[model samples]
Target: MVFQPASGYFCRALGAVLVIAATGAIAFAQLTIDADSQYRYAQSRFDSGAFDEAIVEFNRFIHFFSTDPRVPRARFQTGMAHFNTGQFQAAAAIFNQQTVNYQGLPLDNEAFFMLSRSHARKGMFEQAMLDLHNLMAIASAADTIDQARYELGWLHVDQGRWNEADQAFGQITPENQDRFQVLNLQQALALSDAIPTKNPTTAGWLSIVPGAGQLYGQRYQDALTAFLINSGLIWAAWESFDNDQYALGSVISFVGFGFYAGNIFSAVASAHKYNRDRVAEYRDLLNQRRQMPLSLVPSPGGAALCLTIDF
Candidate 1:
């Protein structure tokens, strides 16, 4: 047999290796494109406010592309989709899960923020505060840290803990201090002196004197209405009874007695309501809040999630 040149043998082996490498490269690239396309489609739906549909697509992306770098972002976006749909409990659960599962991502603070917001929306105020505290512990960025502090102040105000609110606000660096001061001022007003309410028991006792209880509750118009109606019915009942019209007197007396009882109940209820309204009105005045913008977007920043706080 004729011996082949060494270069020729080497060339044939190299060609075989190149063919296999190219085939593998082509398959890898196709996979990347398919995965990226699916993600972009899901993102487009999310951007269009197709939240329920987007959640399904995002879930599919996570299941099919578990190893993809975009999975973390996909998971976060699913939580956001739930939030937008007003499924706050589900949203908080998803966001909290992401914080533990994808701890190192820059998305951590954003997830925490969303989770806190979800709890707050559900009126789970203590849980919301706890999440905000967690954010404070984990966030090193100045804005993120400051945002947590600011929100904590508002939460304390919501709890009607003005002193705690002031303490939280005091921890702020005074960068946008006046805005916070305005909030604190509202908090102070919320907890400030208010209209004194008549005691319910005293109001019921006064109601027997007809209109006096309502007047004590500072309901002048109601007092006048209650006084006139009660007085007229009692007079009519007395006149019928004095004239010896037994049937008319019986009916009028029954009606007059019912009115008198109703007046007493009304006075006591009104006093209690007056006190509650005083607190509620002030609470409403101090109940203002805002949220920062969040995105799980790929950009020049390179991080999977972005948070842009507005103060």
Candidate 2:
């Protein structure tokens, strides 16, 4: 028959089990404390505008506390740090990953918006629009949908797509309209149509005469320069031909004709530049009038949006 364990052996085994349990509990508490400290340190770095350091600390928190409830916030801050550093592509990637990882959560909406903004910053308008539209489609909350639409309008504005921006703004529910910079934005959009713009085609046609297109575009200096250069070359060519210097005349004529064509192209380009500058000026004015909503306020538990009217 098997020998039964002694009473002393059973007592020693129970003591060892209790000691192990106590040690485990202490270790768990220490881990929690360490995680909290790490997160706090990361947030401090971010608050100080030390984005590079913040990114490192945030990554550390994410790595060490993968199961922590604050992981989502840490991930978001990491992306925001990247954004603040102008690493737009990197920021977009992080935001996009968050959207996937936190699908159906509030973080997902925030991620979508940030991802779209990052894309827009990188001049990836198509991708930005896609993200915003996707958010609008999936969002059931009026506030979320309205924010998505508002951001969509801004994206269109960035691309000079005024009609599209107007449409996007129009889709916002009337009740939520007051929450945005709607009146100024609508005024800006309306003013876009009335802004004086040069027609590239008309400018090109006017350039048939050397310097005429530049003059049409109100580039007086360029017009004068083109006119003088073209006239001097034509006169030189004529004199050369009259003096029987046929080779010199041919060269001068060829150069003069080249300059003439270039003058026309320059005029057309000037007109286009004028139009672009006008649009940029209008955009700048709109920016001056609108109160941009980009400030992030740190809350007790997380970050909150300070303003509702985001650019």
Candidate achieving the largest TM-score: 2
* Candidate that scores best on lDDT: 2
Worst 10 residues of 2 by lDDT: 291-300
The RMSD (Cα, Å) of candidate 2 is: 8.3
Q: Model 1, range 1-311, lDDT digits (tens) per residue?
A: 99999999999999999999999999998767467788988989998989999999999999989998888779888998998888989999999997775353457767887888788889999999999898888767666777677788777767767667667777766675664564555456555465455699999999988888898888889999999999998899889989998899899889889989988998998899888887667666665433345545443237455653322
Q: Which residue pairs come into collision in candidate 2? A: none
Give each model's whole-structure lDDT: 0.79, 0.85
Global CA lDDT computed for model 2:
0.85
- Clashing residue pairs in candidate 1 are none
- Please report how far candidate 2 places residue 269 from its true position, in Å: 0.9
TM-scores for every predicted model: 0.70, 0.83
